[model samples]
Target chain A: MSLNFCFLGAGNLATHLSKSLKEKGFNIIQVYSKTNKSAKTLADVLNSDYTTSPAKITINADVYFVALKDAVFDEVLSKINLENKLVVHCSGSLPVSVLSAYSDKTGVFYPLQTFSKQRDVDFHKIPVFVEANSEEIQNKLIQIAEKISDSVTVLESAKRKYLHIAAVFACNFVNHFYTISAEILKTKDIPFEVLQPLILETALKVQEIEPEKAQTGPAVRFDENIISDHLNEIKDLKNYAELYNSISKSIFEHHQNLK
Target chain B: MSLNFCFLGAGNLATHLSKSLKEKGFNIIQVYSKTNKSAKTLADVLNSDYTTSPAKITINADVYFVALKDAVFDEVLSKINLENKLVVHCSGSLPVSVLSAYSDKTGVFYPLQTFSKQRDVDFHKIPVFVEANSEEIQNKLIQIAEKISDSVTVLESAKRKYLHIAAVFACNFVNHFYTISAEILKTKDIPFEVLQPLILETALKVQEIEPEKAQTGPAVRFDENIISDHLNEIKDLKNYAELYNSISKSIFEHHQNLK
Candidate 1:
């Protein structure tokens, strides 16, 4: 029989991950959340029992998956007892040590992709990074990860933290630029759809070419005329102008070092 | 007969645009660049004559496509005389007046996509923005643009400049973030490939959802603890930390405004 799993937290990441696991034939036996609505919503989708109270969390499951916010790990985990069952937290930044105090068999199962509750992602393509306190638990976690992902690696907490930071730069910060682009286009009465092709192409280019060699625009060329013009246009918007100047200077310096 | 074209720059954009037009059955009659290697290289591919001297540019082509650098437009355009022939420039930031002095009929034919000569792009899907001095030239430019692209819009110079700025943020600066991500990953002995899925998903997410609504990360939540930890970790890198703080503050303020 497939291993029984219990989920702690039912946010975007938990919802997507639990549904994906269920689709792969694993049994998600229960879900626990601080909020009843979120718990019940995701639990209903998985056909699993759910409780808003941490003390009511099921203890018989073979594995426990904690997907809470980093800030609440202690308060949430302290209330539940898993009794040495394999426990995994799906976080990009938090270390496995956060779960070690609560269970002897603890590990991390982090999928390196952004998740939205409304969107469905192919887990087979997402890289899942795993880490555990013992080899047995590590292998057990890897087996589960390999079921869902084509690429699974045993990453330590040290390297995982940097990976998380790099993700912030690549995904979170990059999305902010998209937001800025949308705001700029909005001022001109242009639809954001016009930028979709360029944005997609830009990301696609880096897949084949090194990002350093793939770089373009006034900053790379250090074209002061166009750069100054762009700055002047957005100078009224203090934060944007500052970001434009800072990134431009960074790009110029980076290229200069390349030469 | 198809239109005869003379390309006045042999850079990435010129090579791609000229080759795309040739593939569509247009006749590329000549190629010109300040450097003979660039001129001859693209000319050899197109089976066209080439010249390094601006004075030697062919004046008899039906359309003169000038794709030179923005700063050198005056110095280059002043050297070629197109008489009453249609002159079109492929620049995002330049005004239509830049080509007006060289021909009685001048227009702008800017493709809103990034280009690299090593990669082939499907121009049929790329949006082509056109502007001209008159309705006759505008319609003529739009017809040519439509032949290559499914989406063609006649936008004024005033609005095109803003579009260009948005592209810089979306394509140029966004690529810079990719570079930074690679650098951060390198320090930890991690390949940049690990971030590719996240990077691509971030771009793809904006296609179906508004960027403001799609935004995620510690910044949007204003998670002080995680933000401070990340800042401390990258404090040694002056520029990266500055950018981290700046963009985080911007994201925080932006989401706060929505509330």
Candidate 2:
């Protein structure tokens, strides 16, 4: 059966995901956004109707994706009238049941990766996370998502929450660490490009070893000399000094606990 | 003036470096290593004569690169009887004056990047850290390094020591981190390729921002909720748990201090 999709937000994820779904033989009947123009722009591209108001979504679609800010889920659901039509919110942090306010047949279609407006996502490679209200909805959602991605998974809300938290550690936190490293190199008049290979190699390592097992540094080695030298180097930057000290200490302490 | 060349060690570094220098228009007259076979192999490649003994190095290159390990510097220098032959060691941790016993014309050409036999360096981008016995050697070393790389700097041993420490944080430590992240993904049946972009962008952020300014995470944000959840998720992995707690605490503490 050809599934139909109506997306509520014509943002990065919406624009990319809708086009991908449409290309995968799904019928995208409508697009809606807070801004009328953004909705119309996406709707025109998807060959669907564009509307400024969620209340104006007159036609029924098999699946409606509400890709909104985390803070506004409740308000947005309250404004929508999906009636018993299947509606899914694309969020990692929000619970699957959060869409129950708008429609009983609701679920989640969380894509577990970072989305930048400029970077076009390869939906085929991206892991589409699906969580539906019932086994029937799950089957449909899974099939629809699988059409767009080979890496589709039926993750429960609880497990999805765990994955989201893990993503925070693996993605957001990791990013900040890189930023700090670049900052240090910049102050020394070193080009940041010098660290590119090192960075690429780091991420690639996880493919072979567990994160816990793969850990290294003065912290893991208990190399006091290098640790002290690092401490001295970042002394002027108190935050960085503390970061270096604490992470190093944690690495050593973690290893000691193992023994 | 075209500088005459001498290589004090034809070990891995000296072999690669001498080849690179020869390509950069410097004459590599002789190759020396503890093993005559290693020396002969490299010497044959360079068309330079081979010697098993540093003391037997009759032909002098303009710059003699002592690529011997840290433990062997004194032993290697004691045998190499030479006048001012512009002796240098390619070690970031060692002082340029370590060659003081052998010659007044001494400098250090420590490339501030990891070099593994499998990975060939882009010499043009590699940070070549240089220091010399005096200002004259300093200028000469800088020009020589500049011939190979634009990212050349004159750092006395003290600054180079700091740079070495920084390199640990950015490279060695960073690589271990990738191992951890890769493990985290793999345990969930997720491929490491999914995490590559995030890892790359994390490092890229540092090129434009200070590591301190670019730092992000639940730790940096002081989000107690996510931290507690993540801590619980890895509770069975106690060593990793402790590491998580400590690093998170450190990042939180850094933010608290900042505020």
- Name the best candidate (by TM-score): 1
Candidate 2, residues A78-193, lDDT tens digits: the string is 76567878888887666787777778898889876655544466777677889888999999888888888887778887767656655666666566555566567667675656
Quality class of the docking in candidate 1, CAPRI style: high
Which regions in candidate 1 have their CA more than 4 angstroms from the true location? none
Instruction: Supply DockQ values for each candidate.
Output: 0.85, 0.25
User: In lDDT terms, how accurate is model 2?
Assistant: 0.70
Writing each residue's lDDT as its tens digit, candidate 1 over B58-151 gives: 8879998988888887777788777889999987878899776778899999999988766788988899999999999999888888888999
The estimated TM-scores of all candidates read 0.98, 0.72
How many angstroms is residue B116 displaced in model 2 relative to the true structure, after the best TM-score fit?
3.2
Q: How far in Å is the alpha carbon of A251 misplaced in model 1? A: 1.2
Query: Over the true interface residues, superposed, what is the Cα RMSD of model 2?
Result: 4.2
- Which stretch of 10 consecutive residues in model 2 chain A shows the poorest summed lDDT? A201-210
Candidate 2's displacement at residue B95, Å, is 4.9
